[model samples]
Target: MRVFVLDAKKRSLDPCHPARARQLLKSGRAVTYRYYPFTIILKDRLVENSVTHPHRVKIDPGAKVTGLALVRDDISKVVWAAELEHRGEIIHQRMLERASLRRSRRSRKTRYRKPRFDNRRKPEGWLPPSLESRVANIITWVKRLVRWCPVSAISLELVKFDTQKLQNPEISGVEYQQGTLFGYEIREYLLKKWSRRCAYCGREDVPLEVEHIIPKSRGGTDRVSNLTLACHECNQRKGNMTAAEFGYPHIQAQAEQPLKDAAAVNSTRWAIFEQLKRFNLPVEVGTGGITKYNRVRLGLPKTHWIDAACVGESTPKELFVKCSSVLVIKATGHGRRQRCRTDRYGFPAAHAPRRKKYMGFQTGDLVRAVVPKGKCVGVHVGRIAIRCRPSFKLNGFDVHPKYLKILQRSDGYEYEIHSVSSPGLKAGAPDAI
Candidate 1:
């Protein structure tokens, strides 16, 4: 990915090539500013004298992971891309654990407290903590990118699948109910529901055909619940027999179940869309249909960032991907607020340090330590966990704070650059930098 650049006055400028940034640093023209999204500050340049093009920040929001892309629309080029992994599941689990602990403590106490469940009223637009975190994560990154780059517009994939329409097609009115694109929506929903594999044979990497669980001749309608994907062999072998008669009763049951991930995206998509409007930029919204169509039309592989780049109708016919790497950011929130740590049985295991920082070093701060002579005898660079003593944990090695130099403060998120030849091409093959 290209390196973000800022003028001497701390104003955002156009990001420069990695090689150009290197030359600027080596020649004493620019100095390092931030480490995570690797930015630099020029010593001689000013934003007024430099020309910067308008960039669009596109988002492909998901339940667990969201894709972000910084696109130079004027040139139809993608300059930077990132995949943000959310902690909704983690947050949910933590909330459950906290509730369990509270209940246990209350039951063990002598003084009884009355339940006040009905006393609290949720305000309008209220979302569960887990769902709210996803929206916050996307908005945080959008704000960060806007500050780092010249972002003028935003594009978002507002909805992946219309659950209501999928369940009751007639509610969409006659025109859309019989529209050509209706089948496309159903097929996409099925693909995601069945994990893109044959529902009967579990076969993948082959052409999958939509098959009826209960044959239409056998009193089955075209409802989504009766739909299942099958390979040609399975489809032919099963013939007109229902799924239960074909030996897989579970297929029908699973088909009737709603996709939890899809529901999550639907719940928070509008929240993100509305929150983004506060940025005072044109927030373009698109459906999953157009995103997939653009990706297939461009012959690009399926990846979150690529989906983000192909989000809106404004996407160019020809897209130029200018980066060979993508930034993978995972939300690892700051340490918990509880001072006491508990065990699995809700017993106090240990107490946290009263002070978070020691000797000006805190846990999760990126630092570099040079060990003069010891078992860890070389320079170690990584996040550090500080204690009351001078010795601190640096990449699992004990190092004195005197030898440690802070690089970047803790920001509740971990960052890594993954090398990719093309967008979403060989996605599983990521060489970390």
Candidate 2:
């Protein structure tokens, strides 16, 4: 990926190639500004003296993972891309645990208290805490990218799948019955629901056709609940027989199950779309149909970052991916606010430190340590966990604070760059990243 650059006045400049950034640093013309996204500040250049092109940040938001891409519209080149993993499920589980503890404590009857009535009213547009966190994460990154790069526009995949239409297409009349988008929505929903494999044989990476659980000749409807993806061989073998006749009775039951991930994406889609409009950029919204159309037309493989690059009507016909690796960012929130840690029985197991920092070192800060004469004698580099004493934990080893040098402060996110050769890349397509 290219390195983000800023001028001496702290104004956004065009990102430079990694080799150009190296030359700037070697000749004392620039200095490192941030380490996570790898940004630099020039000592002698100003934004007025340098020309910067406008870039658009495209987002493909999912339930558990979101894809982000910074594209130069003039050249149709993708400069930087990242995948952000959400913690909504984790947050929901924690909330449930807290509620259970509160109920248990109330049953003990240690003190007499009046029961409160259900008079609390939620404000308009209020989402649950779990869903709100997903919106906050996307908004936080959009603001950060705007500050670091010259972003003039934003494109977002507003709707992944229409659950209501998929359930009953006749509700919307003729348009829903015979629309190009309805087919795309159903195909995408089925792919996600069946894990993108053949329902009967579990074959992957091959062309999948939508097959009926009960053949139409057997009085089966075309609703989503009756649809299942199958490979050509399995579809042909099934013939006019139902799934049960094909010795896969379980397939029918699984086909009727609704996809939880698709529901989550639908719930938060409009919330994120409304939040992006507050940025005052040219916000462009696209349906899932166009996104898939562009990706297939370009012959790109199926990946979150690649989907982000093909988001809207503004997507170019020829895309030039300029990087070999994509940055994977996971949302690891800041430390908990609770001062007391409790065990399974709801008793206090241990008390947290009153101060989070010790000896100028805090937990979650990336650092490098060179222990001179301890059991851990070699060099170590990772995020540190600070204690009240001088010792700190680095990659599961103890080291003193004197030997540590802070590289980057914690920003509530963990970063990792995965090359195209990594196992996460699907379809075995040639590396365009």
Candidate 3:
């Protein structure tokens, strides 16, 4: 029985109050009929009187007290005792008991209830089962991607407006700071322009927020012309800088796409290659110290590699680096050849086939791992890492490697090969030799 300390006063609990009598009422004590007797504690005194009974005790408002105790299937009998204090000495106390207030719950031998399902309404859609399954899979994939990718990065593409300047700063001297009313105005304008479509992925369902092209603090003006509608994730990834600043290695921006448009633009960059024709590097490559030059010198646009490709949808990794681009086979220091690949948006992609072993999972790769059974159980089950590492590190009870195990192919779907369990490390688990 659950007991509670409701309202406390100077009096000791008494066991003979009407509340105690109510406990007895819950369980049938009278000899005539076996109907369950209802119980009610009319006053605070009755509750205060029943604190010593072995069955239960309580002192509180009637509503809370009522919720605390009830006659149930297994709890057929109840005994209550009251506890109180008075005049420097403990006072009234009472003990109440009741047998079984057996109410007829149900007649087991009765006939079954008639079916009540409606058959008139016909199902609407005509989609095939396989198509529905594919749609579900796509939805799951998109959801996983959203979860895995940083919100800031996604937000940049969705919001396409300047949060720094209200009217043209050159025209109106009003210098609106970042994340201010001007920013909201720019965000609002973009939302109206795009009708809430994701500027990158063309997804219309997800809501978009306003993002700053040039950071507000960096003397960037708050102008609707400069603002864009991007999702929250993309906005965060863009942070407080022009897209031209982030130098990612995996994804590059398209060359034909000019940097003049107000749509959130990310600069694309190609890796420094030994010998290449189609690829363009931002810096001059040589055996001497790496001489980094501005994007203008390399015949490229102003936006950063991160801004042009990583933040926007439909931006392809291959566009950042052409196969014809000279691959810097190796680098001595930051001097001779810094190995560069196309910079990815949120996730780092496998640049070389051989590099896959060194890297773990990416945003979409499905791998079987384990999770702790409960908060403290120490037991675990196989799980999948939906996102990439580095950008997101697995820590504590949720993503710790101590509880992970990758599932292998060919084995039955039910079985999984534990990474730590293996004698030798393979598949990026650990080194076996």
Kindly give the stretch of ten consecutive residues in candidate 3 with the minimal lDDT sum.
88-97
Per-residue lDDT tens digits for candidate 2, residues 269-335, read: 9999999999999999998889999989887887898899899999987877645788899998888
Q: Model 3, range 192-214, lDDT digits (tens) per residue? A: 76678754445777868766555
Query: Which regions in candidate 3 have their CA more than 4 angstroms from the true location?
Result: 1-188, 245-433
lDDT of each: 0.85, 0.85, 0.28
The global Cα lDDT (0 to 1) of model 1 is: 0.85
Off by over 4 Å in 2: 110-116, 164-258, 422-433
Per-candidate TM-score against the hidden true structure: 0.77, 0.77, 0.16
Give me candidate 2's TM-score against the actual structure.
0.77
Best-to-worst lDDT order: 1, 2, 3
TM-score of 3: 0.16
